[model samples]
Target chain A: MSETKKLMYVNRKAPYGTIYAWESLEVVLIGAAFEQDVSVAFVDDGVYQLCKDQDTTGLGIKNFSATYKALGDYDVNKLYIEKESLEARGLTLDDLMPLVYEDEDDDWAEKDSIKVVSSQEMAELFEQSDVLFNF
Target chain B: MKLSIQVNEGPYNHEASVSALNYTKAALEAGHEIFRVFFYHDGVNNGTRYTTPPQDDINIANSWSELADKHGLDLVVCVAAAQRRGIVDEGEQERNGKDGNNIAPGFRISGLGQLIEAGIQSERLVVFGD
Candidate 1:
């Protein structure tokens, strides 16, 4: 096994409109098996993926928003949502689903997985990553 | 330098696959080692042997096949993505009970693990897509 590296999946597209959002999530889930330090960043139109109450029945598509909640089980708890991106789209943290994870280090205590970061902070996060998977 | 590439769009329709191919060629020309090239999303279309572009237009898939043949490149199409898009190899066709296999020469259908492995093993990972 290779040494664990900071791997970030950068999501910048809207869900359903294109396959990128779902495919990015698929990679994140599949990549989890490798036990690498993983972080998912929702930026630009990507912020729409977490919007609560995503009803895809009308579109005849599988509603995958629920799948994001399962990331905690895979030990993928780091989710960084860009504040600027959300604000630009007239959305707030309340508009997004509350995603949480059980922390093994803290005796299985549930904690917030989504961290709303500023654009500057997001840039720093990008610099910190060893590999960036853009979607 | 050791590099890995990911192409997330289909050939011709988007410039992504072309850009990725050109980048891989340039990197190899400059004496760089490409650990792997993982095709995901519609990019798996690049591995279909059934592509029949006109004589005037470039057959991008064939170009990739030729490049892989010459360089011994690991051209991997994500199996899940390929299956979703109907780009199947003989093994996949047998396993999935498909009537035919359309995987181009020098291309193999593999799992997403290969993509993650490329990210981990390569010195740099480049993605060409929208």
Candidate 2:
């Protein structure tokens, strides 16, 4: 209602091993409807969520990985990946899905939304957020 | 300070629900204003009256019900999550054609927007779970 408040949705779990990741994504999708300043942070096992080639066919579970791509359309552009988390998981930005959003203010130019930041920078982001929803 | 609470885990299986209850009770006793308590994920299980633990153990949902009644707290169980887990109220029961509703007293089924609203309105938002 008031001017947008900075909201950080912190994900710390793997996408499939538990329900946290999927539910967190649901919250983000719903929260996006509110038109608030939103940021999604992937830390620890949460980093696995963005890994490309996610195959859930054998698992017989609904694969929600592709939903992350749709986030751009919701105006939820900021996706922060902790550098340490990716390294610990032996993943690089190259291993992640290339998520991009169109810049409406700049003639709809496409730009990358994923930003690999250090843990310190993640902490600074934590401080910068008006509210934090952890999953 | 005005605060909001989020519970992400189910009762008994994890200590999170009870811990949230304790923390909320403490906060209320300390004279802090609780803007809302939004239950999501498996946390919606905390709103069901179907939980029947050992007689010696605590009834987590009842504890929350009693607390909400006493403090006039807003205990909101997310509708989407609740429907998934089958924690329904009378309205949900009628709409979903459920045989009966299991929502406990003082707990209401609502949308995730309640959570976003809590984050926007509260001075502090506390989360309890992994």
Candidate 3:
């Protein structure tokens, strides 16, 4: 078996407007299938991707937010959200989907856990990963 | 590590620019050099200096300029994409009979060589699309 490498996936697009967001999620899933240690970070408008309620039917787009909930099943649970992004959007921790972790939470106490982080901290996540994918 | 970063969305149109910036910062922080950052399709809009987002909104063009200023990062915009979008540098402006160059301060209009170079230079090349 090939040695597993750590990878970080950064999602920065909203869910419905473009294919970037969904494509990024697909990449994460592919990485996980390879047994790579995959982590995903949602920043900027990408935070909208994890909103508790997403209805893409009206937009004629498939709803992929549910796929995010399945990340855990693939062990791709190192999901992150930017603290400032949430606030700028007038969204709070509770407004997001349950899979996300805020920067303040203890759940991400471990170095390997998926957690929310500041912009500065996000830089660190990139530094640590063997591969960094931005989508 | 060979780093090939593909930026697909336009500047300020979404968070892809910020993510690209953050990814660049992280790559540099990790002591790794960036191979190349390729701006394609709508991503070519990122190379324009003429953009002015609302004061309250984040300035992606400025963010990209800062990255180039601080790190000397190579920002490459696909010429075909740029031309189609009406984004050209001074030389192109003269050749195409355009009024002026709209490219951002730090960006350079180049061909796919830069993209190929990025793929060969970085250990991992990631694509950020919109």
The clash numbers for all candidates, in the given order, read: 0, 0, 7
- Score candidate 2 by DockQ: 0.90
Error of 1 at B14 (Å): 0.6
Query: What are the per-residue Cα lDDT tens digits for candidate 2 across A1-135?
Result: 867899999999999978999999999999999989999999999999999999999999999999999999999999999999999989999999999999999999999999999999999999999999999
- lDDT, residue B14, model 3: 69
Please give the range of 10 consecutive residues that has the lowest summed lDDT in model 1 chain A: A14-23
True contacts kept of each: 0.82, 0.86, 0.27
- Model 2 segments more than 4 A misplaced: none
- Candidate 3 chain B lDDT trough over 10 residues, lowest sum: B112-121
Residue B55 lDDT, candidate 2, scale 0-100: 98
Q: How large an RMSD does model 3 have?
A: 11.5
Tens digits of per-residue lDDT, candidate 1, B27-117, equal 9999999999999999999999899999998899999999999999999999999999999999998999999999999999999999999
Error at B48, model 1, angstroms:
0.6
| Root-mean-square deviation (CA) per prediction | 0.8, 0.8, 11.5
A best-first ranking of the candidates according to their TM-score comes to 1, 2, 3
Q: How good is the docking of model 3, as DockQ? A: 0.13
Model 2, residue A128: displacement in angstroms? 0.7
